[model samples]
Target chain A: MKIRHRDSDSGKIQLEMTPMIDIVFQLLVFFIMTFKVVAVEGDFNIKMPRMSAGGAPSDQLIPPLRVRLTTPQDPNAPVCGIYFGQRQLASFEDLRNEVAATVGGGGPNADADEYEVELDCDFDLPYRFVIDAITAVSGYRDPSSGQIVPLVRKIKFAPPRQASGG
Target chain B: MRYKKADNELLEADLTPMIDMTFQLIAFFMLIINFTEAEQDQRIQLPKSELARPPEQPFEVALTIQLMKDSKTDQELIIYGGEVMPLANLQRVLAREREYLTRTKRSPADATIIIRADGRAKTGVVQQIIETCQEVGFEQFALRAQQEEAG
Candidate 1:
């Protein structure tokens, strides 16, 4: 009897995996490049004052007015701030006048458009200061438009940290 | 005349390289992933305001106070930031930190008192922390809370 080897069984299996490997490594590199391990410090747990009443109805994006409260030049003290817009306003009255002028110039339906004035205050600042700031912003109205935008309504308060407490 | 026939035609896929690359990619994501808690494990949510902007300069180290219910006993107050210090001492420590920052001319503004109060933690305790932060020279603060859920 003669011993015979099977030629088909003897051949090595060759799989074309170069492209697959390339993709795998590419994905690896991509993830490595984009991966960020942020050491987020601080405990994020508190009941933030409810901001949205029903969520600003789907249609409204208006210019925002800003009111920032700074630590009185003295760090050991309470907070105070300067209220001014691009147009220099000497007093609270001037701020109101500028707002009225701006709104009046905007023409029809400008009043219907939402006007948001945001108050920026430190967490440490007495809530009273924030309330007071809200009051000031509320007093400004465009008599021509008969629009009375609330002072602090539709407000967004952010944490001083890069990320919000949430 | 007659012709001879071929014995075999074989094809196989090599998976060695592909498997190696997949392992490497998985490793990369494993190393660089940042895991922020999706929900407040402690059930607290933070407020958002537009006025909140990043500090001009990175803040220097200061005492931080974390208020959590004791994980073990559930009765004691667990205050851990740098060390476990009593809330009463918080004001004194902050005032001292303020003077030191001022003496160093580093701007007391750079030091912040991070208050991490559990959602259930009484508002009174949070108020106390606020009072201390105000009494001390520290003006900068970051209130931490879970983000609200998307509706």
Candidate 2:
């Protein structure tokens, strides 16, 4: 027996939207949930070509200014004292001020192009302090403009001090 | 009493706007997503610097070295190519990299060695790593840090 209803219009076939919508929502959720916020990273480029035979300090246009970071005798100290040239400094800020003055503002104030810095760090000093020192001598962010004023672009490391045990 | 059939009316809410909005949201998220984080290892807590701005141009050839040092135990380790080993064992890895570069007709001097070391790691260890890279014929180095906003 065949049944026909007077209220039905049966010619059109409707597509199912439920599964597509479900999957779309799932895709959206997956992307959103897996999304991460990563901090911007940067680098300090140091071009230290291998020293030629005979240990020549050759081809240096300007002698590098020495900045030594001294580790405290107590192995537990978090930061190191900075010795910029002959003057022993208390903080990285001091080192920055001294370097800025010595580098002088070239271009308008002085020539930072010919300037260089050689960092001599201790065997056990935390690496962060070295970066702090590098950040200090390399440049300072202008407080008002928030612009980074580069100081010495050329930075090199002195030979590592002897390891305490290993 | 007579009940009316609703199926003949073909009732459907408009879904076009909802789907359009969803696709827009997905596109926005896809645009902002950064895939470079895969190259970074979460184990190393990098040093922060306000002046550490990203380079204006990417290096032509780069090799990343992730260094980790246990503060309490002083056990240093190097993470490269997803492999971790003691710091003293890094020479072997560097040698392999140098060999690979030479075999591929690329010079080690052409590659910039990028060192991403933990903040708590020793400065001497970093220097030692540089020396090892230099010994491997790598002339260029990059010390990486997280960018901190000026305060």
Candidate 3:
């Protein structure tokens, strides 16, 4: 007995394009409405000050470098005074130089566990200034690759001080 | 000499080009859409920083906190999940998050917190939020900032 391999009524199998087109249009509308074009975002990783858990004594050799940020007497002053240890910095450039020097110009000493930069800012100081201070001390821009090669990996905040009389 | 009537029924619109254009639009939108916006608050203007760089790897999971301040009063408004909550309530939410992590057998140290604060927001307020997170045992933090425009 010969078996019929094909359908008795042979015709072009039509695909309903209307439903598929409708769904695709729906998806296009959804995406268009929800789309947002934003610049790439980045982060400055910070470790929140935590109480010591009494681990083994650190083998750090270098002492922590301190930075102090003080607001001006005038409430509306745009710039704040930045200090590296006991010496006052003339500008953010000066702060960077001081940090580079303290961290040994991002040399081998910069890799030491004890090499830390602690930021001490008055409570009234704007956060933008503090961020500038962080950026200044965080690293030096490598001229060759134009990348920020981190100088001091360890950073912490000194307990914020109350704003004094302005 | 009689003329034959011509068929006008074959003039249907060609939907193939329309479908192609729609698909192209869909592809463009799909490529540009940022799903992360769900976790970000448009109200917060991130501070720009020269040292800030994009994370090497995206965190598998993170809790986003948005901090805003009243321009006139300087009072902080903490936003979580699109709702404004007091700082005390935020701590409670953190506690609940910690509990959820514990139940999931994940350590708080493994959890990450992202703080998106307005550029003008006070540093002290941001620090307080960080300290609060620290108090709850979260060790990793990502302070979001916009990349400084190069001159």
Candidate 4:
């Protein structure tokens, strides 16, 4: 004997929403789990000249400005001393001011082309200190526009110095 | 007792609202996701700098090197192409990269080397890496740093 339903509604079609919702939720969860918010990263472009065994000595007119970074013997000390040539700088601000002065007062026609800053850092000095010194000597803020103008485009790294006994 | 049946009614839940919410979530995730995360190593904490500026133009060919300190040995380890290696191995890798670039008719000067060193890492280690890169004929260098807010 054949059995038939009395209330058969086979002609109407319905889309299954459960599975679709399940997949969508899964995708949302995946994306949310993988999402990472990171701080903006940038780069300071530099040109590293090829190292040569020997080169002829030339008569150079201007000497590169040297910035020496000395770290305390105590590893726990967070402060590092910044020096501009023979003069010790009180802070990064002082170093920046001294750099600006040496670069002819940050004028429009200031001869930044002839300026080069040599960063001589101790072997134990943290990388943060080197970048801080670079920031101090590399550029200056424009008082009028509040924009950072490049002062010394060229930067050279001197041989790392051994940390002296404090 | 006999019961009389009422009219049959089909119940449905609207899926439009659910789909709209999912799409909104997808958009938010897409905006925050970083495709360049592979180039960045979470083990390395980048130094913060106010002078760090975004590149004027993206380099067509760039190599990223991540430097981090080994917690166990307290020695600097260089991570290149997701492989952690010592300085000698890194130098060899750079040499190979330079050779590959030369074979592909690309100038070593055109290829940019981006160094991402930890903030607390010694400056001398980074300097040595630069010196190694220079020895391998890489002229263009980019020091990666996080952009710090100016006071």
Clashes of each: 13, 5, 0, 0
DockQ per candidate: 0.08, 0.72, 0.62, 0.67
TM-score per candidate, chains pooled: 0.37, 0.86, 0.82, 0.86
**Candidate with more favorable, higher lDDT: 1 or 4:** 4
Kindly report which residue pairs in candidate 3 clash with one another: none
| lDDT (Cα, tens digit) per residue for candidate 4, span B6-105 | 7688666687987998989988887778877778888888888887888888998999988898768878899999888998888899989988999999
Which parts of model 2 have CA positions greater than 4 angstroms off? A1-13, A52-55, A73-79, A106-109, B1-13, B71-74
Q: Write the per-residue lDDT of candidate 2 for residues B80-143, one digit (tens) a residue.
A: 8777877778888889989999999999999999999998888888888888888889989899
Q: Report the C-alpha lDDT of model 4 over A1-166, residue by residue, as the tens digit.
A: 9987666665666687789888888888988888777888888777656642112222334787889888766654655888899999888889989999998866788877688777888887888777777777778667678798878877778865654433
Best-matching candidate per lDDT: 2
Summarize candidate 1's per-residue lDDT along A102-139 as a digit string, tens digits.
55533454552366664455534433344334434444
The TM-score between candidate 4 and the true structure equals 0.86
Q: Residue by residue across A78-165, what tens digits does model 2's lDDT show?
A: 5588898889998888888899889884225766667889898888888888899999989887777767788888888887888777
Candidates, ranked, lDDT:
2, 4, 3, 1
In model 4, state the lDDT of residue B116.
93
Superior candidate under TM-score, 1 versus 3: 3
